[model samples]
Target: MNKTENSRRRGDELLESLYNATMKLATTTKLTNLTFQQIADEARTSRTVLYRRWSTPFDLLQDIYSYKAKKLFDGAFFDELKDNGSLRKDLLQLLTVYQKVHTEIGAEIINNYYFLRAQDKNDNNELLIHKQAVEKHLNATKKILANAEKRGEKIRKISPITLMLPYDLIRTENLIRPTNISKKRLTMMVDEILMPVFVG
Candidate 1:
């Protein structure tokens, strides 16, 4: 390969290919059955390229999920968070978009990485991933709180457990429902559960 082409492949283009390849395979192959050879073949890149960065398919999968989740945070749904008029309204919209992005990232992968595999005592990777996801949502919530503050709404200091209600509620519901949590249920969560905490 020419130096220019090789350079491009070594850059974002290569990472993108690897991420795409991983997700493509993940869609059909259970994580237990996934192989680096399959990912390398799908990406049309060498195992050397994969090995230079990742030691195992598990590591690559973790990075792929982090990349995908980060992109979702940077996407257009965030703009929709602007001035949703009330904390309750803003949260409902925020979580609807949040759940949509999570759904797009695929629940099976999340379930494996975050919940199911926790029993194996894998490592701190899942904890880090969980923290990253929580921070992104809370950062978005910060905006909602700021906007609510501007509109003369009261904001309160919530304990960590109370602060986590939105994420836990949505996450639990998603696990039960699996990519299909209803708008009605979300509304009820925001109104009946979340509104009391944020606006109480």
Candidate 2:
């Protein structure tokens, strides 16, 4: 490769390494505990490189926050969902991934996003961004249900609130337990609670 191509590839690799380190650290500590030194150590890099690229931890954090948002519900997550032919399988896929995220870094991610959002109440950009993310997920869910209907699955009419019930229930449980909701429990939720509502 030429110099420019090599330089671009190196830059991408650096960012990926930093991002992986940020996510791993996020699982173990609060956002307030994150530091350039810690991230550098986790990424196995020099602090000087981080300092040269990012003026403050918060700048790096903003990039992480945006990345986490896109990673969670957009991009490859949705691509995998679209390939699942069964609604039940689709629900399982989404929830299984979500549970893993909750178990790993749910609290830190929540705290970081809300803390930054709270810091800018007058701006409202944070709220708008969050709302847009939710809408995108909801639209994906709607398409899943629509596909099920097309396949002649026995599904009842569902309201928006009912469609959100599974996640709301999971979030509530997380607030109480702050751990990964087990696969068995998630399956029970889909089969017993969420599926009943959709099919009956």
Candidate 3:
């Protein structure tokens, strides 16, 4: 590789390492025990990189949350959302993936984020990151709904927020109770809310 290519590769490696370190710390340690120094040690890099980029752990975590949330929505989570000729099946699978994300990382990260944000309400950056992530998911959900509509389902007029009903409910369930959401509950969400919205 040329010099510039080498430099880019090195930068990417460092960033991946840092992000991995942050995620590891978030998952393994208590929220109160997180520090850039610890992350640096875990990542085998200098703490200055984190300090120069983010003013606080919350800021770094905002990036982490946004990145992971994007991956969750755009990555393998949506791979099976194509026209399967069954809206119920597609929705159930999608909800199951969303629930997996919540059970795996979303619950702890989001809970810690709210706790930290409550301690310092001036962090508009975190809020912006959060809003962007939510919007991304909303768009993805709309795409899925559009697919169902194209498949001859009579989807009703619904606002963006309303489109997020199933996802929001799963997120709330994760926050309230850190356990695997039952497939029955997911089916009920579809039968009770999603089906009505699409078929009503």
Candidate topping TM-score: 1
TM for candidate 3 is 0.66
Model 3, 1-200: lDDT tens digits are: 33333323456676777778787887788766789889877777666667877887777877766665655544555555565576787777778878877666666666765677676657655555455666767776787778888888877888888878768878777777667469888888788877877665
**lDDT of each candidate versus the true structure:** 0.73, 0.69, 0.71
lDDT of 3: 0.71
Per-residue lDDT of candidate 1, residues 54-156 (tens digit): 9888888777666766645345556665676778888888778778877887786666556435534845565354556566666667767778899999998
Question: Which of the two, 2 or 3, has more TM-score?
Answer: 3
Tens digit of per-residue lDDT, candidate 2, span 79-196: 5555377778777776666666555555666556656666666863453455665776677678778888887787788788877775566666676666546788889878887777
Cα shift from native, residue 17, model 2 (Å)? 10
Q: Per-prediction TM-score, please?
A: 0.70, 0.59, 0.66
In terms of lDDT, the poorest run of 10 residues in model 1 is 1-10
Ranking by lDDT: 1, 3, 2
Model 2: residue 33 alpha-carbon error in angstroms: 11
**lDDT comparison, 2 vs 3, better candidate:** 3
Pairwise lDDT winner, candidates 1 and 3: 1
In candidate 2, the residue pairs with backbone N, CA or C atoms under 3 Å apart (3 or more residues apart, or in different chains) clash, namely: none
